[model samples]
Target: MVITYIAGPISGNIDINKQAFLNAADQLQSSGRVVLHSASLPVGLTEPQYMDICFAMIRACNEMVMLPGWRQSTGATAEYYYAKKIGVVVRDFNQTLKVSR
Candidate 1:
C-alpha cells in the first residue's frame, strides 16, 4: 500500500480547513487508498511525542500530499521541503486526479 501523508495547516481558528482535510482523507479511504493525516495527532500531546508521531507517519508513508493551504503552515512547508529532498512523491491535492475514480 502506498501511504500518502496529508500535510496542511492545523493552527489558528481553522476548523473548516481541518475538516476539509479529514473529508479528503475519508474520500480517499472510501476508495481504498491509504492516506495519513496530521489531524490524527492527539490534542495537547507533548512536543517530543508530537515529533515522534509525525516522524513515524512520514517514515511509514511512501509519499505525501500537501493539502490545500499547506503553504500557509510553517511546519507543513518544512515537511514539503523535506519530502522533496528525500524523494518522496509530493503532490498537491488540488491538482491530483483520483485514480480510483
Candidate 2:
C-alpha cells in the first residue's frame, strides 16, 4: 500500500490544524488509503523536534497529501518540497489530487 502523509500548520492554531490533518487522514482512509502522520506528537517537544519526527514519518511514506494553506506553514512547505526532493508523490486537499512531482 502507498502510505500518504498528512502535512499542515500546527503551531499558531494547533487544535484547528490537527483537526484538519485528522479530517484529511479520515478521508484518505475511507478511500482505503494508508496514512502516515504525526498530528498527535508526544507532548513537550519543540518545533524542531516535532519536525524531526515529521520528516522521518514522511520518509516512510510513498506520498504526501498537503492540507489547504500548507504554503503558509513553514513545516508543511518544507514537507512538500522534501517530498518532491525524495520523489514522494505530492497532492493537495484544496483541489483534486494531482501529482506535482
Candidate 3:
C-alpha cells in the first residue's frame, strides 16, 4: 500500500476544522493506503512530544497530501518543508487534483 501522510492546519481553531480534513482522509484511506492523520494523535500534548510524533509520522509515510490550510500553520508548513528536504513526495490538494484527474 502507498503510505500517505495527510497534513493540514492544526493550530488555533484546529478543533473546528480538523474533522473536515479527517473526512477527506477517510476517503483516501478507503484506497487501502496507510494514512498518517494528526487526528490519530492525542490532544493537548507538549510541543516537543507533538513535534516528535509529527516527524516520526512523516518519516514513515511515502508521500504527503497536504490539505488547503497546511501553509497557514507553522508546524504544518515545517512538516511540508521537512518532507521535501527528506525527498518525500509532497503534493498539495491543488496538485493532487491535477494528477488524479
Model 1: lDDT equals: 0.77
Q: Alpha carbon lDDT of residue 34, candidate 2?
A: 86
Cα lDDT tens digits for candidate 1, 1-101: 77888888887756886797798898777766698877877688775576567767887788787887888887788778877877788877765545556
Model 2: residues with Cα > 4 Å off, grouped in runs: 96-101
**Candidate 2 has what TM-score?**
0.88
Residue 16, model 2: Cα distance from true site in angstroms: 1.1
lDDT-better candidate, 1 vs 2: 2
Tens digits of per-residue lDDT for model 3, 1-101: 68888888877786676885787677677767778877678888997788789889899998899888777888788889989999889988657656654
Q: Give all candidates' CA lDDT scores.
A: 0.77, 0.81, 0.81
Runs in model 3 with CA error above 4 Å? 97-101
Q: Estimate the TM-score of every prediction.
A: 0.84, 0.88, 0.87
Worst ten in a row by lDDT for model 2:
92-101
Q: Write the per-residue lDDT of candidate 2 for residues 1-101, one digit (tens) a residue.
A: 87889888877888888888888888787777788887878779887898889899899999788788888988889888988999998877755243211
